[model samples]
Target chain A: MVAQAAWVVLLLLGIGLLLQNDLGSRLALFGIQPDLLLGALVLLARRMGPLTGLAVGFAAGLMQDGLMPDHVGLNAWLLMTAGFLCGHARESIFWESSVASALIVFLAALLHNFAQGVLASGFNLNASLQLLLRSGLPSAAYTAVFVTFVAYAVPRVLRGRD
Target chain B: MPAPRTPSDRAAFLLYIFLSFVALGVWLSPFPSPRAWVTGAASALYLPFRAVSKGVENLLGLVVEREGLLTEAAELRRARIGIQELREENQRLRDQMDFARRDSLHLVPAWVLAKRSDRLGSRVLINRGQLDGVRIGFPVIGREGLVGRVDALEGHLSRVRLLTDRASAVSASIDRSHVDGIVEGDPVEGLRMRFVSYSADVKPGDVVVTSGLGGSFPPGLPVGRVRRLGLESGGLLRRIEIEPAELPERVQDVFVLAAGDSSRGWGFLWARPVAPTDSLAESVRTPRVEP
Candidate 1:
């Protein structure tokens, strides 16, 4: 359990660093970058179930929130909810198939990006729709594509390695 | 590997939701919270990583553009020589006109880290912070003119709010007319100057500079030029539009003016009088925008 916790922390920190650096800038699509931390949360929840997923997602989101200019808890709340939902889905939906895993990642990315736009709007109902269409939509699509690619490819590579 | 929906899961979910609301409340709170410390610590940790990544990128770019860099170096060398001569001439003129030298100003130079992606406001992250004597409200200036002021500060990183941000407002005066007004930003519609009396003479092409009335910014710093002038609907003050002198997009390095330094007000611009042949001088001498 301690080893797993350590791995989660390391992965979160690594992703946070990657997101802020030039490596992240090089990967930007229409000024939107992939949310690797969010992807990690989805994968963890899908594999480890809801309880562990919630904890890891919250921790990772907190780190991400700290790095970005937005409110500190915004990412934490969104990612935690995402983790819970993904973890709960594991019981009924088998994400063992790469396509299913990719779909989960795509939906999570879209939801996460949309929530981020909502939070940035400070819950202003007037600006919410505009923010969603402007920043949220493009970011969601870009991140989903990246996350889906990772989800599909990583499993294939790992299986080949085994 | 579906974990069963046990009582523990329900309990954890309830607790997590409560915590999430608390976090949301903290975010909405009017007062500063402890989250700033977390941000500062995380930024400090990420600094080394950022530096290494930037260095690697620079190295890669150098390898890819060796020939281009060589050509750029030759151009830079000629530009440097021209700049050196211009600097000497400027110094000579300043001395000739008895303009106050900014010897007391302690400027902290910093490199831009990353520009913020927020659409609501314009901001850029810089590699200077509390450790470098950078504080909120300090004026950030580029080689050309005013860039912005530091909005948020961390241990080793700071966010500078550009003058083009909608939230930005600066007290300014026309250099030729000596008419005072407030210059404000509209992120979408560009910058606009307000509160000039209808009787005051303002025309397109008039230079605007800081008035130092608010104490937030020093006096006589070049802000922008008047793009257009129009009467306010109220028939009291004229609404003057301005174009910013410095473009934030092209800025790589900026100097943060230290706080509580009143000795660094811009006096260099006063060294030369506005030319009598200037068209705005006639407009300033005679009010053009009638009530």
Candidate 2:
């Protein structure tokens, strides 16, 4: 249990560092970057189930919140909800199929990005729609494509190693 | 399907989710110290990455453009001799005009860690902060001219509010016309020079420089150029649009100016007499927009 907790903490820290690093800024397109931390949360919760996923997602979101102190727990709330949803879907969804895993990631990214954009826009319906089309949509598509590639490739590589 | 999580796990998950929601509900931040610690740690971790990125960039430049750099160095040597003559002539002109030498101006160089041009405001976080003697309200400038002012400070990071930020205002004047005005940042227009006299001989393409009335910013730093003159408010003030000298988006490395020169008030600009005007400025109902 302690080892698992340590692994979760390290993973969160690593993802948090990537979000702020120079590479993160370079990866930004139209002022929107893929939420790599959220992608990590999806994978973790989908495999470990809701409880572990919820803890990791909340902690990861808290790390983001720490960087942007004014937006205190906004990301925490969003990511915790996102984690729960992803974890709950694991039983119903065929997890072994890479396409199903990719679909889960796509929906999670879409929901997370749109919700974040809406909240940031102060719930202005018109602005929220614009943001969803511009920032939220592109980021979700990008993250989905990235996770899909990772999902298909990583398991095969690990299986070969085993 | 796997059985649902144990009762204890379910309870813990619910509690954590509830706590996060409560945290979002509160406007007041109760975890200031922890947040500060995390930000500081994040900044500290970022330092080495910045160093590595800069080093790799320098290495690539040296490898790819070694001949270009060498040729530039040779060209600079020839330019240096011509520059010395110009410098001597400039000094002679300055002495002839009796302009005070800015020997006391001290500057601290900092790398921009991040530029936040989001909904909140246009701000840049520089690596230098209170630890590096960067005080709030210190004027930050780029190679060509004024970028912004240090708005906030931390241990080793300072947030600068760019002149393009709506909250920003600076004392500025036309270099050729000597017309005094307050330059303000607009969300749409990058910069808008406000409160200039309607009679002032200002036009497009004129260079704007700091008027030094505020004393926080050093006088004569190039602010921007008059892009277009808009007769906004159509009566008292001329809303002259300006293009910032250095685009806030492009600002990377900047110098935070520490004014060694004491407050000169209006004495410096007083050498050249401005057109005396009526006291209608008191009647204008413009909000006192402090930068």
Candidate 2 second chain TM: 0.54
Worst 10 residues of 2 chain B by lDDT: B271-280
Model 1 achieves a DockQ score of 0.18
Task: Classify candidate 2 by CAPRI docking class.
Answer: incorrect
Question: DockQ of every model listed?
Answer: 0.18, 0.12
Tell me the deviation in Å of residue B214 in model 1. 97
Give the per-residue lDDT of model 2 (tens digit) for A39-76: 77888788887766667676667666655665656777
Q: Which ten residues in a row have the lowest lDDT in candidate 2 chain A?
A: A14-23
Task: Kindly state the fnat score of candidate 2.
Answer: 0.23
Scored against the true structure, residue A1 in model 2 reaches a CA lDDT of 92
Candidate-wise lDDT, in order: 0.72, 0.73
What docking tier does model 1 reach? Answer: incorrect
The sequence of per-residue lDDT tens digits that candidate 1 reaches over residues B1-291 is 233468977766775777677656556656665478657766776666667767887998888799788889999999999999999999899876553334234578998998752446767888887567665567788887788887666667777878888788888999998999888876765678998998898889999998988667888888889998888898898988888887767878988876332233323321122223222224336533311
lDDT by residue (B1-291, candidate 2, tens digit) is: 234477855665666657666646532357566556655664564456456667988999888798888888999998998899999999899875544543345688998999878554677889987667666677789998999987666657877889888888889999997898888887678999998877889989999999988655667999999999867665777889999998988999999875333233123432122111211122123323344
Pairs in steric clash, model 1 = none
Candidate 2: residue A108 Cα off by (Å):
1.1
